[model samples]
Target chain A: MFPALLHDALTVGAVLFVLGLVGILTRRNLIVMFLSAELMLQGISVSLVAWSRYHGDFGGQALVVFVLTVAACEAAVALVFVLQAFSRTGRLDAAAWQSLRDAEVPRRIDRELPATDAAPPVWPQLTPAGVRPRRDETAEPEREHV
Target chain B: MIAALLPTGTTPLLAAAVASGTVSLWLLLPQAPGSDWLGHRRGALGLVLGVAALAALAWAGRRLGGLGDEAVFQIVSLVAIVGGAATVVTRSPVYSAIWFALALAGVAGVLLVLGAQFLGVATIVVYAGAILVMFLFVLMLAQPSGLAPYDRVSNEPLLAAIAGGVLLALLTTSIGRLSADPPACCTIPSRADAVATAPVGPAAADALAADPLARLGRELFGRHLLAVEAAGLLLLVALVGAIAVVSRGEVAEATRKGAS
Candidate 1:
């Protein structure tokens, strides 16, 4: 039962890791790319916990604690860099920093994009509530500011 | 003829599933080649293929090694895997972050089922509660209104999908093989059995736990003391580094302005 559980958990981890890999490789959004990196970390965490469970060793669980710590530190530092990059470039696109790429690498030029055909998001509209009060023209105008 | 073309072995079937999955992912990525053929309909087709790919993956998994019998594991793992895929493919960074949170929840559930009760809860509290919220905050700070062009297109979608899918197939296959001949060093140990019977020094025995949580605490404080201190130091450095960069960057900006 435990072995089966390990195998299944590992399979799930593999799937997640792959998804993250694909995301980081394909997506051009810096934030999304970092999110993919986090997803990979998560996959590693799950695998570690599963192995720890199977072995009954505190080693795996202990490692997970360290992973959490490291991930937190990484996020803090990396997000600062991301923010800095964004400030410099005014874009969250990872491709925006291709100037830093090796000179031998081919430059990435974007192809012309077709106009967006996606429908504008439907916003909820609230119906006007309650009746408008009638103005009383008969009332005397009392206070003008001194 | 169709039956003749079908995969006869686990490896072949897994390969087939992986190939199909790669195509699905490629199609699902923003601005995939041939995506213009269907105008706005390509996304729907990709969704269909993605689901089919998942079903095939599940089938291949059952053949590779018997999947766990627990219903909860199946549900949570499915949630995690599906959420992870969505997190990757979602065009909007905000939506991606939200999907990632759901994936984190599913991971937490998987951890709980795996019996690391503390880690499971910690995953949710630390990852979902803290880290994910941070990701959302960054997205809010950085994302331009509406969709950016980068979000509407991908970098090498076909190659990326193929690479990821092939790697996944390899990993799952390796894990499946391990199940057939699990290492003798790591036999299954129940929670109570592990706690009660773990070989320990006389001093360390006192640190041994009556409960899993206490046991974890003992391990953390007792066995891994120096590592913990180092982690703390790392956190401090990260904090200082982040602040320094932000401040120095502003100073540099001011200097550049003065020079100009």
Candidate 2:
């Protein structure tokens, strides 16, 4: 027989689902948004399992297997999309993709996006270790800037 | 509406507790002003208020029905709720991802408590093991440069919290209503009817009531055979799609050189 915790289980699942919803709504980072979507999936899985136990049926458990499959595919496709977007934009912010919208829609802001706080990629500087490099005065005074 | 949902005796106290708690959470979560999380006065007050709401909800639940799987439910649900909220509120994406795994572990605990042995274990294996790993992998590659600008600020915390609170209240209240007045859909069979309708053959009933995991396998493979095959096809397609997507960058580069 199903125990009396049925409502409690549902409530907990709902709570988690709502919190995940808030995460998705409030966060702008694409990866975090995807994680929040996964959170929502977890919430639904919890509810399905609870209902399965209540009915003394294994159908819900079987269904969750499908859910897992879908979630996996979703993650794969979504990550690929993020990678592609990052290659073009060089950042993970969702706002960067506003260009994808229809031309009729007004832009939110005309100004350039604020410079990201993330430090630019650092490359190792190869300096001559043994001796001072001789500058060729004849080579147009070797410009100071690259 | 709150009064209509809960019993008359606990209604006022419950409403006050829930209201104050929502307010506290609203203030506690990082707002536009961005108060210091560790030492802020409102943050501490929000924590207390949130705990008070949890206590009130538990009390109401206990009063309505005897705690089923009492200890396990209490501990796991508490942990799940706390971990979930933390996942939502944490500023750092990696920390949020880690907290999400913790929340997922807690949800898996709930699934176990509900007698879903396979579902619980699978959730852990699939989510914590595979999905979280993929998330972390993408997160790392995407953010090779530390925290991004978007991670530092939330889009709309207050509005999201209000929406979340409203949805939570609606869901919990519906749960309470359903508990007090169960819908006609789920009618449990009486012992006499169960025995009378039971399979006459000993093996039949035994097989039906065999180990849950074994029964789950039978149900999946036997009843849902087509769905299972379809799922397999879907997985294969996804694998191919992922491979194609990842390789497109190189293919495009090669094509560009040929054209030039």
Candidate 3:
């Protein structure tokens, strides 16, 4: 019975850890990543508590108190960052900021370059008389300067 | 005191039976929709099941001559695992947090059973009251979308299989090793009799009678003072860090507006 209980705890902990890992790996959204990290933290806390019980020591349980505190602190910081990012760009899609990978550049070169060229790209010229330029078309000139 | 408590054998058996019955009931209850409020039928059913499970486990422990430290540990671990899994699998974040709190409470119960009264109480105070409430707060404020059934179906099975396989391997190996050379006798003490002997009026007094708080205080203040202090400082740092993080978004937005 003892073994069975221990096995269950370990299984749950392992699942949480794995879920967190997958979330971190596959999830592009920053908020989801933060949540996944919380999952991993939870996994470790449960494991620690289990070990403490198995050994008849309070240390493991005590450590969990600190871990919870840390998790709370982490969530606060991460969410703030997420909110800030969201405000800057209306969308939360992670891929939207692919251009931010470069430290010096504020805009994506691939997106902004064609219009700022000595001549606008042929694609725009090919548009029918009534067609309007896309939203990204306006930023092309600034992109080429960088 | 130990001698006075040791004579009663049936009490432990009764406790064990009750605890086991409660656990079984919890497992057997029909899955409730996660959106139901605590007052709803499903919520009531879950609560009833939880209580039954806890009662059964507690009774089982008492009946078994009070669960040994290791047994208590395992029981708590099982509770936590079940509760945690429920939290993750549930469709509603609110329900998930509730289950998470249950798991935390179960961990505290284990600590108490193991004679780590201070740790157990602290676990409940910090985890159930502070940590889980914070999770609930975030869930409310953020309002992340409810977990879609397809999402759960797609991910849970694979995760469950991997976790189960690993756990099975570990448990099988450990059991094999232990069986090769079983221990002679129980090393852990049973507290059921002591607990049962206490007067039923005040819970705190009853707890103190079993294990005085002074001993724990001495241990904390004497040898573990440094560690305790460190933990305290860590908590302070975390609190400050959380505040900073949560407010940073607003700060950044302000700065951006000012710049513009």
Better of 1 and 3 by DockQ: 1
Q: What is the C-alpha lDDT of each candidate?
A: 0.82, 0.75, 0.50
Residue-level lDDT tens digits of model 1 in B1-260: 21222235555766667777788788888883345567667788788888887777677656544453577887898889888989999888999999999999899999889878898899898888888888888889988998888899999998999899879878966775566554677555455365558886554454234477877888899999999999999999999999999999999989999999
Residue-by-residue lDDT tens digits, candidate 3, A10-122:
43455446435544443444444454566667667656655555544445555665676666556655565555566667544455577757787555222211212124335
Expressed as tens digits, the lDDT of each residue in A9-85 for candidate 2 is 88778877887898888777888888888888888888887777666667878988999999999998889888888
By TM-score, the better pick of 1 and 2 is: 1
Each candidate's interface RMSD: 2.8, 3.1, 8.8
Q: Order the candidates by lDDT, highest first — what do you get? A: 1, 2, 3
TM-scores for all candidates: the values are: 0.86, 0.79, 0.50
Best by lDDT: 1
C-alpha lDDT of residue A95 in model 1? 91
Q: What is the lDDT for A5 in model 3?
A: 38
What is the clash tally of candidate 2? 0
lDDT of 2 by residue, B19-40 (tens): 6546655655544332345444
Roughly what TM-score does model 3 have, to 2 decimal places? 0.50
